[model samples]
Target: MADLNSLLDDLAAESAELEALVAPLPPEQWARPTPAAGWTIAHQIGHLTWTDEVATLAATDARTGSTDFTELLTEAAPRIATFVDDAAALAAGAPVPELLQRWQDGRAVLAEALRAVPADAKVAWFGPPMRPGSMATARLMETWAHGQDVADALGIRREPTDRLRAVAHIGVRTRDFAYAVRELPPPADEFRVELTAPSGAQWSWGPADAAQRISGSALDFCLLVTQRRHPDDLALQATGKQAMEWLTIAQAFAGPPGTGREAGVFS
Candidate 1:
């Protein structure tokens, strides 16, 4: 596992990259529909900012228990929804330059709060208590996934990067997120994953001796688990019925099942 400080640095770098990608967008594009149904670029950014604030609360010992964490997400969802609605309303009449500045400001707040967390601390998250390192990893996953939405809306492409490893790690660790959404317990046995990393290297997860195997490119796996890309779009090869079953419902993000968007919409 990577050290917490290193993970924080990685998240910081990705956050900066995300800001750079969206900071200069013209106002008219804020209302452009992203691959996510009914969400525009503004909505995506709002959701990202809201999630960062929630992460900040988690890292600060603010969550009294799991109930508090759950409530936080529940409450924030509507607020973020409203934020998107309001932003889209403004986009109808507001100048593009002003909307872009607002995006920059919101992202700045999120970046500052993320940097404030202590690297060695443990914090409440959607699932198990996570160290700062894992929390930052989660943040990076969100940034990359949501940034993909923004990129797709703008019809732009971002080069694959080793940074995607953070997303893949979350996808594997949160296998239970998939199960939870289906109202099922996590599977009993571990599954092995062999994927090609962005740097043209191989990566593996789970027990080496496991009977089930899921192999593919790291980008495809990350996108698959995040529900940003479909398994069929990549060179995914699954062996063992259990591994294939898992792939049919994999989800890395915390939420109910998504609306099952088209595979590789971003690709």
Candidate 2:
């Protein structure tokens, strides 16, 4: 379920975009808090840099990753402090330029590792094993999602790009993952998902005639899945019971079910 090449390209583009934004800012801005509550802009990029290094290790190393990712799902809502959070906090004190360079270097190494692996070979991760392609896609999703927080915090409105197609693809593919993370039995019936891309092209997944359907702008759908924007702020529509339920709790990034932004919380 991964398009490795496109995912990798998008990953580079996204990292570059975020770096460009943070590079010119005054030092104090790096310490400013993003919408993610206590996390500052530096903290978001710090997490990205740490994650890139871990993902590279999993893709190239014989052993999979170090932790049981799903082990934390039970502790989802309140989100107790874990190793990942601690690492990000520690990295937060590094100078902004150093953080940006670290992220750039780590992601380049990850790109090389991903390309060397067999396309269908599974790479070990915290929750489940993913093919190199899927692993790269997951990395792209995390990068873009975190970038959104940085953008919002800096008060910059990024114009949606074709790169979103990769992100939207993951959001659709992770439908079952989202439900599974919450310990709910995924619905037996499949749902149709359709989204209008930035270039005005339509993209979709699932059966065309499924009783359940969700359709809207690709950007809005992406925002919903990444937990960046509450569903109420998007132009999305759901036709059946399952579709409606998924909209309320859907997430593409792994771990526990995220406590999404409250309605009307973000303008």
Q: Score candidate 1 by lDDT.
A: 0.73
TM-scores for all candidates?
0.81, 0.91
- Model 2 has an lDDT value of 0.83
Q: Which candidate number would show the highest lDDT if scored against the true structure? A: 2
In model 1, the runs with Cα more than 4 Å from the true position are: 62-121, 264-267
Model 1 over residues 72-146: C-alpha lDDT tens digits? 657757675454445445453445565555555654554455456565556776557776677778878888898
Local accuracy of candidate 2 as per-residue lDDT tens digits, 16-52: 8888888888889999899887899999989999888
**Candidate 1 pairs with clashing backbones:** 27-96
lDDT of 1 at 175: 81
- lDDT of model 1 at position 33: 85
Q: What TM-score does structure 2 among the candidates reach?
A: 0.91
User: Could you tell me the TM-score of candidate 1?
Assistant: 0.81
